[model samples]
Target: MRQAGLTEALSGLDALGRIWRRRGVFAIVAGAVLALAVAALVLLPVRYLATASVIIAEQEPGANTSAAWAQKVGDPADMESQLLVIRSPRLLRQIISSPGVAGAVVSECERGRLLGSTDACQRLKTDVGAFIDHVESRFSVASAGRSRVINISYQSGLPDVAQTLANALTQTFLEDQRTEGANSREVASSWLWQELKQLDQQLREADDKIQKFRRTKGLMRGANAPISSERLTSIGQQLSQAEAARAEAAARLQEIKSEQERGPTDAPSVLQSRTIADLKQQLTTVSAQLASAAGVLGPKHPSILALTREQASIQQRLVEEMQSIAASAQKAFDANTALVNSLKKQMETAKAEAGSATLDEASIESMVRDTEIKRQQYAELYKKASELETERRVLRGSTRLVSLAELPSKPFFPKKIPFLAAGMTLALIFGVGAALLADQLGARLISPPVPVTPEAPAQQVEAPAADEAPAIVPELAESVTAPETATPPPERSSHLPSVADVSILACLPRLKSLREMSALGAILQGHQPLAIPRVLRLASEDTDFQHALRDLVHELGLKRSARSQRIVVTSPDAGDGKTTTACALAEHLAAAGRRVLVVECDVSHPAFAEIMALPASPGWLGALERGTPLRDMILPTAHPSLDVLPIGATTGPVGDILDAISLDGLLAGLDGYDAVIVDTPLPSQRNDFLAGTDWAIVCVRSDRSLIEPAVVTVNRSRALGARDVGIVVTMTDVEHRSPPVVQTAPVAAYAGAG
Candidate 1:
């Protein structure tokens, strides 16, 4: 994990390094920010401050009230309210409007003496609001530790002026608070009055509802079920009493009636009657006399007759008394019957009243309960309204002043050290941020550009005045040796050194067009057009080819001076026209009336042998077999001066020709030739024979050459004894501006095919 973290850290550093590599952009941004920081340090001014403090007491609701419901606790809301009140606009304006305030400000201005002219003083006198605003702008109020103590501060150029403003503002705030309290009370009283009246109306409405419901339901109000129940109890008691009376009366009536029905003997009241008793007593006496008379008269007639009259009168008197007793009993019976009927009627009336009272009791109780609830709510609201009214009358401001502001001895702003430090910190932060952004944007633009079409070569940006000038990429400092222009192909006129001094020459481009191909062919075939033809060899008389070849000779310093005549041509890889160039060069040199010899040295892919129509015999081996003198091996071509020495089918490796065979004797056979061109294999294939050659020219296929391999080939040949070496391009595709020339008529192979 630690190793991974280190890798990640290194990767991040690499990314940042790439970004910071755009040093020009980073320097400009960072330098500009740093300059600004210095300017800020130089130009910033200082400011002074004076501080004041005011104690703002927190208000508690209903502090003076004795009722538990009216009491209150400490509130953050009230403290915030006090703060607002202190900073109120009306209060500030009032401070401005105070006596001597304008004079004090103008005097301070004049005394400070920035503008001493009387006109300036007069102008300052008129703008009291400006002074107020100036003071207010610098003023700040803050409380510490949630305490009642608030610190009021103001900054100004002058300490005395700042102090004066703070004290005046504090006084004004105090006055405003008191005035605000009074106004608040008035507003509260008005609101409470309206609310209290509303509560009263609600109470009245409740009472009215109770009264109306009682009247409508015919129920007793105020007292509820208890009244109805008590009435019912009274009625029930009366009914019971009436029933008892009626029962007693009924019993007496029944007894009286039975007595009347069974006569006075069955009734005690009849028997106890005063008139009946008196009459019975008399009748008893009369009956005794009659009995006596009847008994005597029955026996003796006159005396018995008188006695019988007496007895009969006594009997009549007794009958009359019994009749009187029966009459009294009838009267008593009638009185008892009337009393029972009256009691029964009274009981029924009392029962009906109780039944009606029961329904009235239920409705009245519900209405009374409802009214009581309304009364309770109305009472609560009324009490609150009254308390609010009382509060409105007696309340005062809750906040107070603790201490007034004093003059400050020190400046509060534009601290030199801190400001400078902050400026530098911020500048660095912003500078780094900008550099990162620029780098990121540049990365986005670095996507692969579209491939440039084949047109005129691209132009380079102008170099700086001095070599030491900073480059966009520092890595490009060592590339000054390359020519800063369009470089042409080097095959025809290789920009080479003298034949004695040269190793490798410049490279060339591929030839695709007929013009370039023909020009190249002409250079190979020389001014003399061969009678023999193969492929494009017929069009060998090209003016451009001759001009370019002359230029090559001039660069080599070989047109006038020659160190060696034996030159070999080879490529790092095949298909590079090595044999063709060698064969053509020999022909051109021979056409100038020089004895030129051409050899097909490449054992494998022997192209020169095929084109020359040579028989299957290695030229060097046969020349050796022809005996001591080697003249017969040097063969002639169709041209008067050129010769072809084709490598034959030896059926063995070509190294024998380079190393095992007599290399000196082989060249001795060419002593009569003025120029010799050898077509050799790639240096990598067989380099021993290439080293024996006097000069070497490497042929590079322009369209398909690898730079590293070509360079390796050049260096390797130089390392060998063939120090005079040059490079030539073949098969290039470009503008064909050179025209071919008509020199000789067409001919067969085996003639002028150097």
Candidate 2:
């Protein structure tokens, strides 16, 4: 009864079996799809691919060692940039317009013309630009991994055309790189030469400016410095020498004055004089003669008087010579002082001249520095220009063609084997899907077979009167006199089994059996067969039905752990006894000392109120529309523990109301019940209410329901979040039914049952 895993496996197998039964349809669909695929593959034009490889030469000619090392490592970004360059519109335009490429394009167009593709041929004849663009679109450039190799691939309907275009593109790209490099270097050399000429002129202008500034400001150079600075230095040195001479002369004059005060004989000029020395010697001799004569001759001494007069004459002469020497020293001091004063005046004049020339000299020095810088720049540019001119003559391209594109022997597209395999796979999938869809649509569209009832034989009775039985008297008398021989019922063939025998009813749990009751049938004669009172009366009269419902309740209790369980009872189709089963199950649960609430969610065709003989009061829909609490709308039943919330009166769209209504919220509001049994419409109609419920019981009629739809309903319930799901077969022949047995069996066993 709880074989969920087994149920899913059997359901899959049953679906496959059903699909297999429609193999004719599958074959037709698959064959059609495969035929279409083959046609498309055959109609598609074959294209040939040609590839040419080129190695990006990392180290260019005349590159330095360090530059070569860096280029060898190769930057991926640089490689990407090169790829873009190869694919650039300008480069592509150049390549496509070349003579070789144009010839190839013409050939391809001619080939297309023969194949009935006149559009490309017309474009070529009428518009050259569009033709070129069309040709460029056929080729692509991409780097080969992280290496410095680029692959130029061209695709066309003709193999030779593809090869020719690919090779031409490669050759053109290499030539373009070389031309671009040479043109860039030539332009640079020309610009450098012009710059060098301008610098040379500027240097000459600066030199002339410096010279003109010096001449205007009298800043003429003298050995190491300007003339004004040299003159000032010379004046300073002469003034120093004049001041020394003046100081020496003043000391001598002062010494002469001191000597005149103490007697002019002590003066240096007087001491060095020869005239004074000769007079001093004569004075000494005369004094010595006077002394000797006075000592020899007494009192009269005529000779001593003569000697004294001679010595006095010599002293007078010596004083005159000293006076002359002092006059000369005064004259020398006056001359030296006048020279020092004159030198000082000249030094002031030189300093004033030097200060005026300082600004002029600074300006000249700045101009000379500018001239030197220009000269250096001119020399450098001239050298670079010469080198560039030399290198430009020998410029080499940075790429070389490694291999020419080869003409492809086979077409690249419409590969027969792989395309066939893929087409077959897709065809099978589409075929299976179509077959299943057709089968499901057929099942839903075709009506189920009506149950056949054998006609009852008419009884014959005595004729009441000739006139009353005038029309049927002969027939009744003949029937009563006829023999009791009746044709034997046709024997059923053993080869073909009845649908009921192989039905999925055996796979599902047989929940309940109620023998056809004449009394219950009489009560439900003019009303719905699932009328509430009829189900109630059947439950009370049928002992096995009560035990089956009790067993269902016990199974629910064992499977669920929630304190309050929410169970949804639904069927694959309407009138499958879902309402009866829901009500009966709820009653049994309530009878088992558990409070149960029955929520009738089938608002589209509500019957609980009318069938249960309850008053027509507003139920869940009206309460929801009026913003009334659902608990207040819950109607009490005969069983104190059982309650019913019927789909109330409403004029609103039942589908919209059901979709917008929150079943969980409604149940939560009616809180006191231990279990809530939600009786929903057929699962095929409305299954949203099954989400978040504890269990789903799908009811099916054993006489009419098929295995595929019932299994689908069970699986759908599980998919919609029903924690536990099971099927309950209803409307069985209770008289001939055996006692209920709960066990698992293979689907093969059931299929083979008689």
Candidate 3:
């Protein structure tokens, strides 16, 4: 459904072609608008511009050096800030105060309003601002890409002025920078010298504090801040070594014990002299005891004492071996204890030495830090002194300005071509808009003719045979009356003795013999309504029907009044003989010498150019499009009695170019004209036929046979407040018989008889 609606809308727009075809006046109007716009643009003043550029560089130390390094040295923001200051109001005033620049600007602006007061200086200030504005508007500043070199360019109408201003500003800024650079160097040198004195005093103070602190604390050279971190680390390492030695000794003792339990006979120190000699002495005692016991006892005397003595000798040998083992064990314990104690003592001594050395190292580091601080201060002071000396050397030279500005050769203005083109294009758009407006308003003035067809009545005849049934039945009725209203005086009523029944009756035709009689005197007749002009709108392109209707209205005594006798012919769509019919009807009126105004109301589209062979210039739409008045648009035609108001000043959307109200006003404003014959837009294309028009004659082509459609269109026109409706059949070859005339009694005859 949406697609269908879109299609319909496109179709409606397509239908506008008819309007354009008929709207010749609007074309003229659009052309005029563009032409006028072009003319206006051409009359404007011309302007030419020229530009010049200069490069500024930075000053160097004690020599004519490239500005590249200095330019790079300053921060970009700082440079921009300085540039703004160079272009400051005070600086501008100073520049303009110069005799050369001030006289030139005043001379240049002489054609304009400038320099009239004792405060010409003040006026010059305003002019200077304008000059700066103009220059800035044209001027540009940029640096070479990836380089420190800057280009300052100025543009002006006068080539000489451009060059002069560019050179002058560049020289002025350069000189100013030089002076500023020199002053900066002086200030920097002065500041550095003053700072050097303070710095020297501070250096001495810092040095004295260091020396006094060292002396008061009795600190040795190379002493630094104190901490026991390194000492503790050394102590921890020694302690770890001592623990490993003690663990080794204990493990050896346990291994010896375990081996003895496993039946090892020798002691860890068995080979030593002290343990061996004690073991041998115990053995000798045992042997002596055995010999003494044997001598006291007999050989076979069963003496218990001798046996016990022998056992004792053996036990004594065993006791000697055990005693030797115990002695070796004690020696081994003493040796291991001695070794452990030696390792522990070594560890303690190392810890104490490490701790003391750590403190001394810290103190020495403190002295080294102090010495470095003094060295850094000396170096910074020397560098500052050197920089100050360099700055002083660079500032000793003088600088001078090279150029001054001159009068401008021309003023810079915008190009007029684009502006003119835009204006004309805009006007054309408005013209088309005006056409749409006129179309939508339905203020069209021309109409086509409507065809009329007369219906024939059917005939009836009496039957020839008597037995034939009657075509229609006739019925009779009796009247009833009150008794007091019935009189008894009549003799026939008394014989009947009652009221009579009604009976049906038939009448027969009577024919008389043909006889000729002498005619009586004739009377004068009064004027008929046929004297007035009457227009019949044709529904089809049926020339027969169109002529028949015309004859009918004529014979019916119907006509338009003399003042409003003009008629307009048009159609609802194009290809209808709106123009052709208009020309033909105008030709009819021109034959009678009745002045006619054949106004081409369809300004956007015109068809009358072909019909009338009109000069086709100075059309209505053209005048309107050029923004001219209605009177100027009215042009005389070839025929003396017929003047054509061609369509002109039409473009854009129909709505924008022309207004229905304005068109009506234009028609009403045409009071002096006799009769107007407007060749208007198709009714389907626009409603111009209904715009306060006297009569509308709708024309249709004959072959199309459009009676019912024409009726619908005419009815629609009537609904649109068109009281005077007429139709014309065009492009038709059919013939029509004349309508019968009707007779009426004379009003003058009655008056005379009385």
Candidate 4:
């Protein structure tokens, strides 16, 4: 698991290295994106933002209670509702239609006209709806973070205009709230007044109905009751008096009768009479006189007889008076009895009349109750209407202006520091992404070649004998080198090539001075050999360049079997030192006592004749077309072991001859050489000769050749069946005379192609 993780980490590092190697691409892409961002920032129009705030105070009219004043402020739903109301179309329309607001918008539009925004200016001037829409786009309203305060903002190119519009919007909302409250009260008052009038009419009609009912029923009210009721009471009182009088008279008559039965002298009536009393007095006097006379004249005197007769007469008068008193008592008793009977009959009649009056009074009482209720209702409504009118005059809204907007000193949009920072960050991200894409798309070359660990050995396939395959031309087999000697090659050495030397050569610094080039020329002269070109002769010296070449050969040797090898040297473009590298490698192989063959496959621009210092003659193509013996076209260099087959003078396109005569068959005919180096043109130009080769070395010029084509050449070589592929960076500047330290660690292959 740990090994797997380390491998993954190394893979990631390798990918990043590939990107870093193409830093030039990152710089170009990032620079272009940043420049575009800056241009857009400068060209954009500047806008100023101004804000005004209001505190929403919700309160009931005429309410001074602590509960009402301390009601929870800024209910979330209520605040949201209020915000929506402020941004409502009706309120916005009113704000835009106001004189001050309209003028400010007009001024802004006119300013726009001067600034070449004629279309917008003309549309705003001609269409009021469009003007409103434009203003709405710039206007904004929001609550101030869980508080009752609300913020209204506006954006405009002109700072003063923004401030004016923001303030106007806030003022308009407040006024609208006040006006809405007043209108509500006014409507309520109107309804109350109408209701009161209806109640008044109902009360008057009810009173009239009561009065008319009374008149129709003949129900007249007295102090405490109806008149008929009062009369019934009076008759009852009179009947009671008559009854008492009759009772008293009857008792008197009875007493008088009893007195008559017992004799008139003991009767109460007789005793009460004045005439009886007078007669009694007279009788007393006579009796006294008679008694004296009788005594004096006992025997028959005339004076005594006369006195007795007078007394008798007085007693008779008293008896008649008693009879008269009895008769008067009877008459008075009878009269009282008749009067009581009459009063009783009248009381019965009055009771019947009073019963009818009671029914009528009940109905009148119902109407009177209804009338009273209507009157109370009318009074209540009248009072309420008055209160509503008073309240409407002092109505207040739930919002008040907390602060007016001030003119902004700077634009809200296009903030310099933040805008540039954001732009740069985005540009950098895009640049990195683009660089990675370019690397992935084969637009950049692979990283410096690394020494790969040797894998399982490949099975060696013996080459076919020259006599077994048919040659393209009859003389091709005779042109091949003689067979290898019977002696086996020297044993393999234990010394491994330095990995650091190869890396330094692959990532060389730029050669900036002519002095460096002259120093390189001096080094070339110091290591001269007569048989090879001056450029190829430098490989014999123990320099940094020579060590890089040896490392490359050692790395290739690890991949190949211990047998004859075929190597192809090519480049992504022209003039990348492809020929020099091919010749030098061949010379090195010859110096090591190996028989090597150099075949110049670049027929379009062949350079072997001049490099070999040989006179012009019919090259390989001339010998092929004329069917000349292949052995006659074979040329030898000063090195007896290294030979060359140069591309002769051509009459037409090299592609047609190459297609007609198979190069593979021609190479197969050669059997004796230890190694064959075939130098070809750019991979894009011609790559048919790359197939079936043992190794392909792509030559790249440091700081001059692009990584894109170099990477392309490596991939193409691998695709064309080259058993192994590598890169060599040539023409690189040397910083010092001394070589770099050799690293013993085995290097990894190029991440892109491997």
Worst 10 residues of 2 by lDDT: 467-476
CA lDDT of every candidate: 0.57, 0.69, 0.49, 0.69
Over all chains combined, what TM-score does candidate 3 have? 0.30
| Pairwise TM-score winner, candidates 2 and 3 | 2
Ten residues in sequence with the least summed lDDT for candidate 3? 502-511
Candidate 2, position 141, lDDT: 85
Q: Which stretches of model 4 miss by more than 4 angstroms?
A: 1-42, 55-57, 63-85, 113-126, 215-217, 241-336, 424-754
| Candidate 1 residue-wise lDDT, 1-754, digit = tens | 1223433454567557755786667677777887887787666555677777777653635545445422322345655676676676666666666666666566655755655475555455566566556456677876656666777777766677778777887888877666777687667767766766776777678778767866665555335544445565665676566566556555655665676566544366545666656656665776676677776566467766665666667556645655665565455556655655665575577567657766776666786787677667767766766776666566655657788877787777777678778877877677677777887688679843333332312222122222112111112213212223322223333222211222223222222224545777746643332232243252145434443343334434444545447787877777666766676666656555567778766766766556765555547655555443445555666787777776554444445455444233466645766666777754443345554665677776544413445555665665544646665644432231111111322333223433
Top candidate, metric TM-score: 2
lDDT of 2 by residue, 1-754 (tens): 1223433454577568767977888898999989988998999999999999988755666644586568655678777888888887777667756666666787787776656666666566446577657776788788888788999999999998899888888888889988988899899999998898888788777778888888788789899888999999999999999899889888888887888889748566677788878888788788888888888986466787777778788888887777787798899999989999999999999999999999777777788887788888888888888877877787776787789999899898888998899889988998888889888788668845333222311111121222111111112222122113322212321111112121122112223323454777655543444445655665654555654553455445522355778888888888778887887777666665678888988866677886566677788788877988878888887777888898888776655565454456667656777888998854344445566677677787655513456555666665555666655666554432323322222333212111
The TM-scores, one per candidate, come to: 0.37, 0.53, 0.30, 0.47
Candidate 1, backbone clash total: 22
lDDT (C-alpha) at residue 272 in model 1 = 62
The sequence of per-residue lDDT tens digits that candidate 3 reaches over residues 211-291 is 676565444343333223444455567567656655655665565566556654344533344544564555456556645
Across 42-142, the per-residue lDDT of candidate 4 in tens digits comes to: 99888999999988867747635476456545567778888898888788777766656776787887876655656666666557678778888898898
TM-score, ranked from best to worst:
2, 4, 1, 3
Model 3 clashing-pair count = 105
Candidate 3 structure lDDT: 0.49
